[model samples]
Target chain A: MLPEENVREYYMIRDIRDTPKALDAVVKSLDGISEVAASARKFRKIFFIGCGSSYYAVLFGSWPLMKNGSVLAFALPSSELILHFSDAVNSDSLVVGVSRSGRTAETLKALEICRGKGAYTVGFTIEGGSEITGIVDEPVVLDIGEEKSIIMTKSFTAFSLSTAMFSSILSERISGEKQTLIDECKAIPSLARSLLSYEDKIAATSKRLLSENIERFIFLGSGPSYPIALEGALKVKETSYVATEGLHLLEFRHGPMATIGERLTLVISCFLGENTVHLKNFVSEFAGKGADIILISNSIDLGESTLKLPPEYSGECKALLSIIPMQILAYYYAVGKGRDPDKPRNLSRYIQRF
Target chain B: MLPEENVREYYMIRDIRDTPKALDAVVKSLDGISEVAASARKFRKIFFIGCGSSYYAVLFGSWPLMKNGSVLAFALPSSELILHFSDAVNSDSLVVGVSRSGRTAETLKALEICRGKGAYTVGFTIEGGSEITGIVDEPVVLDIGEEKSIIMTKSFTAFSLSTAMFSSILSERISGEKQTLIDECKAIPSLARSLLSYEDKIAATSKRLLSENIERFIFLGSGPSYPIALEGALKVKETSYVATEGLHLLEFRHGPMATIGERLTLVISCFLGENTVHLKNFVSEFAGKGADIILISNSIDLGESTLKLPPEYSGECKALLSIIPMQILAYYYAVGKGRDPDKPRNLSRYIQRF
Candidate 1:
């Protein structure tokens, strides 16, 4: 067994490592997921509200709903929803509140407001008895997603997968692709376990990259992978004190690409789907600008600095595994920088207020 | 008269100064505005499409459409819409393509896809007879918003204001506000002129802030102001080569707040609204983190380090004026860093392809 203090120092890694098992638990919660899916289809519009990591998770989750479930879905940060777009809440709308702690203030307030407006409210929380369970009309709790560390790791993945599962179930009911999506989701644990085997390689690459004096980090992804870039960048910033940003894959070519220089490293989440050509072009452009490039994808032999994932996971499941390498990169960088992975400076386990 | 070299050197500043007149031209084009509004209301949902500064403009513009016009609106990057969310386009949807030059490749392609889906398309462009104009069902061209420099300044403000005008007109039909929103919009040019009067002061502040050895910039805003923060950050990163990011005002507290340090400056767009208290608290917290703070707002005073916009430009018009100081700050910072603001390195006036 690892020493207790050393183990505690790597709480984030432990949480991240538990994602496969956590995902299995979420898959076994079939009854709650079905009920949640049924409640979701009842509304004309759905708003996914959360704070920080959960908000990024909403961004990733909303795509599957729009693409698969054919729903009018939106991912709005809780404060933005409550302060600016509250007028958008109506009886035809559904509010899906996401929180690991289940007591995020702005999310709770937004859920309460939506409920008051006669909108259906659903809660996706890691804690079964949290306040959100009592407030939401339909509550789906995945205790396996609960994390002891302040920064979110396992919860984001589990909740994102759960959202994809719900979306797939909704789509299968309409499209008659029975058992396919569920089968794909069940494959994630084994795929994730295989991906974890590449951690030693990622750590070595991260250490070498850190030595290059890269001053800025740009993480790019498209479609469902887009929000993973956001979550990855935020984790790196919060944990490592590095200046980081995330942008939609092709959108970077427009103007922000001007920021690329010798001091920047471009981390592209390469899914090699419909966006493969464009993503490769983005990589080439940044490479021409003299910035270091790292591609995280299922494809092997994408040249140097590539972190390879298992190639077999298809559809929504690819989105689940794509973010794993980035999480590992952020963790290694934090550890190399001598920062505590479990307790990043100036951040708490949960943000309670402004 | 200023010498030719001096004028060429600071052409961006002149463009920033021209925003008021540019806004007047958009407001004066009422026939086109009314036609666009009527067409806009015909759709069940609206997608605002653009790239780079135009995308940020779309983000700023989509707010009033949802808030006042009661439309389901989204600001999708041109590439994201074309590559990922294409399925969300339907016959009942309206696609509003916003481009400064009207030749942005992804925006044009996305518009074509939406048109193919039998969706009504609207073009908000500075160039007449451009490809977007030929494609959109309803084309509103504002030549006065055109820019000679690679960086966008006047065009973003003009198009954002034009969107506000269109949204307000739609709201008038629903709420019968009797031209109040239009009146507020017409007040923008002069208000912008008043705001530009502080350019010298803003330059001084930029000098002081840059002298502090700041390595990172975090721009913050809320509501319509939020997109301004994004655009501001992008402009600074483009022009100054400084690592920069923008986020919703209070959302900064959740996690990225950990990035705050003595080497960073927090530039916030402050508007006295329902979120004023929370925004102020965010500013104070960052201050306590030892980050330099600059507030751009219509408020009389928020103590030192605040750039005061001309008071009495009430309502959504304040959102238009709030971005000017930021543009100026980016310009001065670029010049201070000895970089050319007119032609930022590794960027073009418009993106032609991936």
Candidate 2:
């Protein structure tokens, strides 16, 4: 490998390690969350919009509002919002656009269109004075510092946590009830810090899997973990240049399970809720079909392959933590295959062109 | 091949050919659609719930209600609704459950939960007096005859047309304006019939592509065509047992574009609207990467590989028509690969368990 490749890989690993610090910074900077939540309560419909990894984060963030069945929250790709669903944004709607660079062209255009429609717009980004800050009615800028790697690792977790914090506060304000999830969100930084200690183990696991010559990867998650699965798949695809897919846990069984074979690897995030038993059964079924299974969970233990997370975190908190190991796996897999994780082929930091 | 496999393949082809007939029956049986639409006007939010192909169908069906920006319409997998988002269903919500068998376990359970929460329930099914019909308050049972094949081809199109019809009626009722799409929908059966004349051409194209030994397939669509892209991917995955993925048109550029290379084939649904130029540019970029491109469009043509649809149809109408070629492609691809499209591995007609 070239000396420059080594330097770029170091940047990716450093970004992965800096996740907890980034989350801590974002958590400490939540002064305007309640006011944003208050304004969100007035809107009948709320849209969380972003592109790529940011889209997955906003999808995770929109979960709190969706779980109560009262607020109608939709998380969409910014391009979809601008081209197709722009008619859905009206005066009674709230739009939240999340981008690490805060200058994703589709997101900026989406925010501008929503603003023109008289919808309340909020921007979430690590950059304080980027284009999105000026386009949105409210800006929740995180002072999490810059990420050197082209792939989003620290900002993904930070943005998801920030959006979840806002959604949880909004849910509480709407229901006139106190929420404990916000407190759990506060504890996520330390949890993420503790997870950083498992980097060596994750790297070893990824190297072992890479040695297997797996041709395809499938990630599955239920509920809030669904978007995490998507982010995991994207991480592997962009960094390692492998064909990977993320789907809702049961949605996999519907048709996608047919792809299970000797050269396939499955990474599943099994939540400790209603679908736990089913998730286990499905994992065993995939394993029986000769596919390798790497199960990530907070509670369920399925022998040696399960990457057990720190228990007692809520679904949202677990969602935030689950992507860390996946990000590490993507990093190591890229390095194992002699690819640079900092600069994946055919991708830029953010899409600025139409 | 076994004689039984041949018989099953025959059934699948017959079902594909019978699509127009089934769609004609569904379009003719819209007697009580206005009543359902009028009732939907009272609800603040609407959820379209289904499993597998039904899920994608309802997603296409939900586009009309989603487009006006007045009503909040969401299409979710039944398992997601029952396990994750049940709390979002309430008295002010209207839930529409769709199943070809009318006995999908998750769909039935979701309907029951929503009904218990006082949400108005509607069920779209080909099977009358099935479990879903008993569970939902309103049953829009199409008297289209049974599908002999395990894969849902005719029923998929029929259910999507029915849902789109209902959604179009609801949008009109809510906005107090006439929808030309509904009139365009009424003309779909004839269009589908006319398109079937090109089956031999579609089969030749599929066989030619299969001969290249493509390793992966990606389908991309925008607006109303997005769910069609997903359904196309599902059809290829379930029928051919190949690794296939479907995503929004621009979402492909985000990160998944890394997978574009020599053994990759892409099927894109390009509407002749705002994103046409961007879609063309992306297609050429992928083509430059040594991937085969199949452009399915109503207006735009990109040389020999473009599968042009009959012009003058609305986006919704074009979405309904685009999948026919994909269905035919999946059929021939399976047959050419010595696999039976009638019964794909690891899948049942309806998921009754969990």
Candidate number achieving the greatest TM-score relative to the actual structure: 2
TM-score for candidate 1:
0.94
Tens digits of per-residue lDDT for model 2, A50-71: 9999999999998888786576
DockQ of each: 0.61, 0.66
TM-score for each model: 0.94, 0.94
Give me the runs in candidate 1 sitting further than 4 Å from their true place: A1-9, A39-41, A68-70, A170-183, B1-8, B39-41, B68-70, B171-180
Q: How many residue pairs clash in each candidate at the backbone level?
A: 0, 3
Q: Cα lDDT for residue A26, model 2? A: 72
Worst window of 10 by summed lDDT in candidate 1 chain B:
B1-10
Misplaced by over 4 Å in model 2 are: A1-8, A38-41, A274-279, A288-290, B1-9, B38-41, B272-279, B288-290
The collision pairs in model 1 are none
- Chain A vs native chain A, TM-score per candidate: 0.91, 0.94
The best candidate by lDDT is 2
